[model samples]
Target: MRHSDVLVVGAGMAGLMAAVTAAKSGASVSVLSEGAGVISIGSGAVDFLGYVNGKKITDNPFNHLSELGEMHPYNIIGAENIKNAFASLVEISNANGYEIKMNEEGLNHTAISIAGTTKPTYICSESNNASRILKAKKILFAGVEYLKDSQPALAVKQAKQYKIFADAEINSALLKSPFGKTHRVLNCLDLARYVDKEEGFNWLKSELSKAAAGYDAVIIPPICGTINYTKHFKELQNLGFILVEAVSIPPGVGGYRLRHALINEAKKLNVKFIENCNVQRAVIENGKCKSVIALHNNIAGALETEYTADNFIIATGGIIGNGIASTPDKVYETIFNITIDSPVSVEERSDKNVFGSHLFARFGVKVNSKLQALDSKGSPLYDNVFFAGNTIAGYDFPTEKSGYGVACSTGYTAALSALASK
Candidate 1:
């Protein structure tokens, strides 16, 4: 049996945020994770609201929060609370030396996606946000030669298509491979880990210096060190080079940088982490959760582990994160037996376009403003249980680009709410 004041049931952005927030309040916190949450492959950008009414958010993402349905997480927690939560997260990250920058002028910043296209994000890391690319007279788009995940030409072409880069001079280059000939495939994550080492740092510095002699800023894949990324990013800036890292696809190195910073901060406060923990069910009684049961692999078959906590926070992530499992007929929360009926078939639930709105994306355990999980009647199901992140769904995070923003806000509020109950 394991015990803590708060038991967070996911290790993704929401779960980590909840755990860290609770721990900062001087509560015993333990995070049970089946896998490293979506942050494992997410861009470091903390996307808030990017689009509403099928249009780009020109300034404040919150200015359009009212446009979304009331059930949306933003409405539940309110914009002021969300801003406070986001501020808390920035303070935590800055203390850990990982800075999450927001638009100083209350405008949204455009981050370069792995596809070389621009996406509106409310807050992003220094590397992901273009450092005045639109104002630069000369820009360089470069990629690691041996890394197959990115291409300089493709990125340059896609970037130029945007109206912001219309008049700027953009050049493409594939830097020589430092890895040398190897039968193994190298990716952005691999390069990021390599950059964490001293030798790799020397190689990257030398290569960038040669390639960025006459360029104002250089756009490249996410290859900053997995640890101390700010230190590395700052060092590169000292070389008179403004480095903007394009967001990458899965095996996201940028996300790993954020994850490392977050987890490292949590560990300093003594937050325990249970890796590869698959929670099976919740033990609820008298409208309060006492403990959760998980199935663990053993030498024979499987083992059941009971973890008890004063408060339980469900930040399992959405359908993709496995917080909610879906079948052909229904979508259900993995724990607590909360189910949402999906009468439509796979084809019916899907949109005609790949990037269109998804019915399954919005399927999650409903929660109130306090982040407490609710019954179908819109009543709190448990006094001590709360939902955060995609687990309490309303708006489409991927489409809105509000993933981390909502996760951090809700997760922070949930932790505070739980402590208040105590």
Candidate 2:
């Protein structure tokens, strides 16, 4: 049996944030996850409502919160809490030596995407800013020998189409893969790990130093060091070259770095992480959650373990994350077996266009302003059970580009509410 003041059932952005926030509030926190969350597969930049009604948002995203539905996670968390949450995230990232910069005017800043398009994002790493990339007098787009996914030419083409770096001379160069002759094919994660080491850093420095002399900034694949990217970024800049990481493909190295940094900060605050543990069910007693049972498989067989906590948070994510399971007839929350707050019929959810709005996108447990899970009658289900992130109803993450912002804000609010509960 394991005991904690707060038990977070997912290790994604929301869960990790909740753990850190609760721990900072002087609670003993433990996080359990079956695998790494969507952060690793996401763009490292934090997007806060890039598009509203098919229109691009260039100003402060918070100003458009009123446009969101009443049940949207941001509305539930409120603007003040969302602002504080971003402040906390910035503080944490800065303390870890990675400076996440936002516009002083509080507007969304443009960032270069993997496809070379300019996308709006709220908070971005200092090295990944499109505004900085545009300011360079001359730009060099460098590609690794065997890493074929990132196309320098396409990136340049897209940048020209978007009028980004229009004033700068853009050049492309193909450099030796960091893996050398040992590995014919290089994965982005492997490249990131290699760059994170001292030997690999020296090799990269040697290679880039050869081609980086004339250019004001070097645009390369997001292969900066996995865990030590800030150090690498600073050291590379000290070599008289501004480093810019191109938007990454799936399993993005930048996203992995962000996730790693957050987890590292959480660990520093004594948040316990239990990996590969699939929480199966919650033990509820008299309208309160007392414990959760998790199952793990080893060489021998399946082992079940119980974790008891004064408060529990379900930040398990949406359908894509397997937080909620769906069928032809109904949808259900994976652990608690709660009926999802969605239209009951499948016929009503069917959409002809694949890219059109998905009925499942809006499927999640309903919650009140306190972040407490609510029943059909809008009554609290469990006094100690709270929900955050994609687990809560409302908001379309993909179309709105509000995933990270909602997760961060709601995660912070959930922690604060749980802490205030008796």
Candidate 3:
């Protein structure tokens, strides 16, 4: 059997954070996952808290914790831990040459989405912050013909509707394809990688300079070199226009950069990842998790293998990521086989409204302040196993916009708790 001091399930934001936190704290760490989680496809920003009761929070999010339900992860862990965790994540990113900006007031920063809507984010990468565009007297919406994800005209029309841009001068410009005549559609990741090379950098600077001359700031899809994105953003800003990156949907370049940087740092710490090992069940004994069994196929062929660790962190994502599974009559945690008490019928579980508040959105493995997974009877299921991210839930990330923020904080908290309990 393979072993380590800590075993983190789900190699997404929370899993990676849990593994890194333990390793950095001097624990030998091993991570197992079916595949990398949604970090690469996410908006690549730490959204501490955005909306409460459909109202946008304009000030320090910490001040508004009273509005959140008591069971929310922020309240469970306390505001100070979240702040420290956010700071830790920022420090790690900066050390890896990835710069995320946090303002002094701790208010949410607005960012441009692929659809051209302005949304609140607690902290964002320097390249994607919309403050420059919001302050600019003149703005340009730059789009590339090859990148269908961003439409300059749509952005121009949509972004202006926000009060922040009400008086700003705005226009749209469709630039020529920097990647010569490749008829296939390109996502943000494709263009960002291209900008890593000399040709792509030259094309962007030369073309954008000519197009964005009159505007004080220009918003473009994320095309900064994924590896040296901050340096590229700084170099391009020297061309006179305040360079702002608009985050694209899915296949996200911004998220990919964060994941890339973190994974690189994890590698430096010698964290091990067991690929293709889909964890099916947890081997719990004596009121503690002893090991986990995963099915895998490799040089040894398809078979079941057991992995033991002193502490285990479960970050397997929620319903969206299939960490929680459901059927007509049952709702449950997949690996632990804990049946969740919920509505008996499907209609009672969810609302007909797609974006409307639904009971199922907040369903997850309930945890105590210590972050240990609790059983249906409200007792600790396993002393050594802690749940992080969407796996331990009380709030809905979709409406709260607190996915990565909670994921990071709870993952770090869970890691610390697991180590402390031992």
Candidate 4:
């Protein structure tokens, strides 16, 4: 029987920003998530698209929405609001001790020239943010096995040119066996077992202990333990170290880092968090929601927990993260069970084309100007339930560098709207 002024579901960028905004505005916020927030698999830059009328080559958030609408018209609407969303994002980033930048060249959308492939690699120059951390003597890279393998070594080498000590190490303690012996299991996350094994964990400890000798901080992917991201950071800090988490690409499992960062920061803010608490369903009476039924788990296993709130932000994320629903047959929403405005013609292409060599993968939920989840009719699902980040739909941010920018923007906007309503 717990209650708060606002209840944020999901810990992704949108959800995190929403909760932070509400909490900062003097609202008691409770964030419920099944796992860590997404974004840990990224370059950690606030990506805004296009230029802002300067030689600096900045991006205009509004233009991003237009570009996205053009690319995936069926899924998203209200292109301009997306831009405004980012305007608010600037405030949040500054408050959080991170600098936000806009690229004028829009080079982030173009193919970066990689050695072997004629196609340029997809990269957002979060150089400014990355540069700040370069001051650190060392950076630790930890995550799922295949995740680290995705990038070409040259990419890491280039980052090193910028003066970053990138050390890639596997945490055997986090490795886990894919349920039942199946070949497909290899494709999934097996690193859980690696981290769990005594020998494996010991090996990592010995290696980190040795590296800890002189390094200033360790940059790790999301290696969340026991569902508490803040706890993991606390333990790491207790060991006397600073942890910088990068973004996680989808299906690749880099999202763990994104989730962990939110968890870590949320704790510092003293925000309340509840995990494994599924929203059985929401009771939206009238235009506002009154309460939600959440399923909780403990040593005794799953139990139903009802939570009441005055405001809410649903940032479950889009298709990639399971916030928006899709399958081999159809696509739709999972939480509110609303009909999604899917594309008229589905792109039935090979897996090779679908995933793409670039990070700007266009797949997931769609949103309108207000950052509200939309139905097949292209209307808002619930005014109170503001959407954010990858789930907002439209734009392929990885390539556009709009992901972080749009996310930060939409997150800020949603919070602003929520606060305004309050």
* Global lDDT of each candidate: 0.85, 0.83, 0.85, 0.50
Indicate whether candidate 1 or candidate 4 has the larger lDDT. Answer: 1
Candidate 1 per-residue lDDT over residues 259-325, each given as its tens digit: 8778988999899988876899999888799999987643247678899999999999888888888
Candidate 2 structure quality by residue, lDDT tens digits, 296-350: 7442587789999999989999887778888877799999999985577776664
Per-candidate TM-score against the hidden true structure: 0.97, 0.93, 0.97, 0.58
**Candidate 2: clashing residue pairs, number:** 0
309: Cα error in model 4, Å: 1.5
**Weakest 10 consecutive residues of candidate 3 by summed lDDT:** 295-304
> In candidate 3, which residue ranges exceed 4 Å CA deviation?
180-183, 297-301
Query: On residues 125-166, what C-alpha lDDT tens digit does candidate 4 reach at each position?
Result: 231123234456554433333443333344444445431234
How does candidate 1 score on lDDT? 0.85
Estimate the overall C-alpha local distance difference test score of candidate 2.
0.83
Off by over 4 Å in 4: 50-265, 297-299, 343-352, 355-366, 375-379
Model 1, which residues run further than 4 Å from truth?
298-302
Instruction: List model 3 lDDT by residue over 319-422, tens digit each.
Output: 88678888997989899887776788889888788988788888888899889877767788888888999887688787888889899999889889978976
Clashes of each: 0, 0, 0, 47
